[model samples]
Target: MQQRTLDILDKVLYGLIIALFVVIPFSEAGINIFAGLILIVLVATFVITRSVRGLDRGIWQPILALLIAGLLSLFFAADKGRGLHKFLSPLVKYVTVFVAVALTARTDSRRRWLTAIMLVTGLISAGYGIYQYGWLSIRRVYSFSYNPNVVAGYFAVLTALSVGLLTGVKSRLWQFVFSCTTLLGLGATVVTFSRGAIIGLVASGFVLFTMLMSKAKNKKAVLVVSLIICVVLVALTPDMLFQRFRQIADLENSSNRQRILLWQTAWDMFLDSPIVGQGPGGFSAQYEKFRLPGAGDFVSAHSVFLQVLAELGLLGFGACLWLGVLICRVIYAQLSTSDQDLEFGISLGTLLAAVTVLIHGLVDTAFLRTLVGTSMCCLAGLAYSIGLHHKDESSETVSP
Candidate 1:
């Protein structure tokens, strides 16, 4: 029963990895909700018939709280359609991530392979950004729902993950691929002209610095390459990058103004509703009606943190925070341990990058949106794999 349970969970995880990396990216494929449903069913079956691992215990209350929050939000939501879509969609996605990671995190070797695939996909995704910059100047490449800011933030996180993997690498060949992938991803980050990406990149670097200080392995090499990358990024895109950073200092800029307004609007909604929010998807639609005629369309709350708070209120926001802290603590605990080298480093990098993206989320909603849900899920899975590896290794060490 135990062996069969492991085999089933392993297949579910590998299947998820392949679907996200291989099937989703190469074409106009939507991540079928059916796949997630099947996986959940399988998990339920395993828990019922076999002795399941206890890793999922950490996530149980958080997931339950999020679901409860989502359900409660429906009663107060101004727009039921928008609320249902927004709340339910993320609820489903986050649950998938929690289950997938908890079940499959078992071995260091498995974690390495997971990192390999995400980094490789990051490179391929960067190709689209490159195309957008060069030939797809027709504005169709990243238009409407897929704006430049979103792409920049998304790839910024990707670049950080790739860099983390590069540092985490053991083999010479893998190390070379990391360098190539980082350059390509960094190139894509440049083209997006996303100011938020720069902030995320900086935050991710700080996390990397913490890792370096703790492990203190490759000091000179990390410093030299990092300096060179920083110089080139600044020198190459001096105007666009500098202007965005400057906007942070000078809040008079239009983009800065827009973000403030969106935040204010969210605040207004939350203040009025207080206990219950304006509803999950209701923010965009309701916000536009209050704006002047002929004004631009307001699609999102801009900040994921505010977006959740405004829509779900204190209860929902608390649940989200709970889940986030659990994942971070679990992964960081593994990374901080002195068990394995490459696998620990990979998990450290992934968790850092994932946390960086959440920080980016405070400014942008790339992962929270459906368009990029698969990408975010894959990143979370990568982090979970890292944690699982450590758990497996520690168990092995104590077996004797």
Candidate 2:
């Protein structure tokens, strides 16, 4: 009876995870609803099992550090209520989603199912964006998100992940599916006309090709195929979009100037309270005071790293850095030890996804947004779960 109950709860938990991923691109409220349900199920599972046996300590340590820093920064926040709210909703909520999915997805079959769901949902979202661009005559496709840049960043991560899966997976069918996903993702990302996201996609793609080429059997094929794809994507790009790309380095561009101003304001905020900074959500509260003359009002610092430095100070920023380092270590370790199988593909995909978010985050709020942040956390957790599974399998093999 107990086993049956556990099995039922497991199914429910997995169902909620699938729902969360499907809703990510379409609705924010849905994300909250499903994430809340996932947490409830996770808590119930812990109560019934009375064990947190498979949780990875290495990853959780940095996660805990970040939470601690956020909590501590709340004391120094300009508005304690706002700080507390930010801490709990995004910080605590995102961590809950990460740990829940990581703990529940303990099998290869489960991981594959989750990956397929992500691919399908990503395809749907990108397809819609393409429709908006071509049929609806939208200038820049935002899909369901408020900002085109946000969706672009989201698509950029998916594009890199799809490419990684394409290179790493062994099945021709799965490769073809990922190939379609990559093309749609690339198309949607370009239509959004987000310079930061495009730059991130390029950077992450370079990293992905480089890593895959190192272990790839047919190096020339990889290089030739990659170049051909680039050429095709460029040739297919609309003239207006091509002009937008050319404006990235133009200092006279209005958007670029505004971004420069926002970055400066963020730096000033960081320098003001270098230790703990102004606390969670501090950037917005302090923006007016630090805004340069003629600078327009804005909420976010526009860069994840700058925002962290401004809000949490060096302490919080350092905790974030620590978490990033640990994540990279785990992914790299798995890549080094694993064969060119599905697990390797998943790990490679996760690594490039992180790369996309981090690179885009340099000039935009990539990881700070709900959609992108939650998605990245889920992917990271899945990678950690895979690592734990590998460890468990090794232990079972060695045991009598």
Go through the candidates in order and give the clash count of each: 1, 0
* Superposition TM-score, candidate 2 onto the true structure: 0.94
Candidates' C-alpha lDDT: 0.67, 0.85
Candidate 1, 267-386: lDDT as tens digits: 777776766677777678578654533335677778888878788888888988898788778767766563555655556666766766777788887767543455566566656655
Count of clashing pairs, candidate 2: 0
Distance (Å) between predicted and true CA of 290, model 1? 5.4
* Stretches > 4 Å off in candidate 1: 1-13, 24-29, 34-54, 108-110, 135-145, 214-228, 247-252, 288-295, 338-342, 371-373, 389-400
Residue 115 of model 2: what lDDT? 80
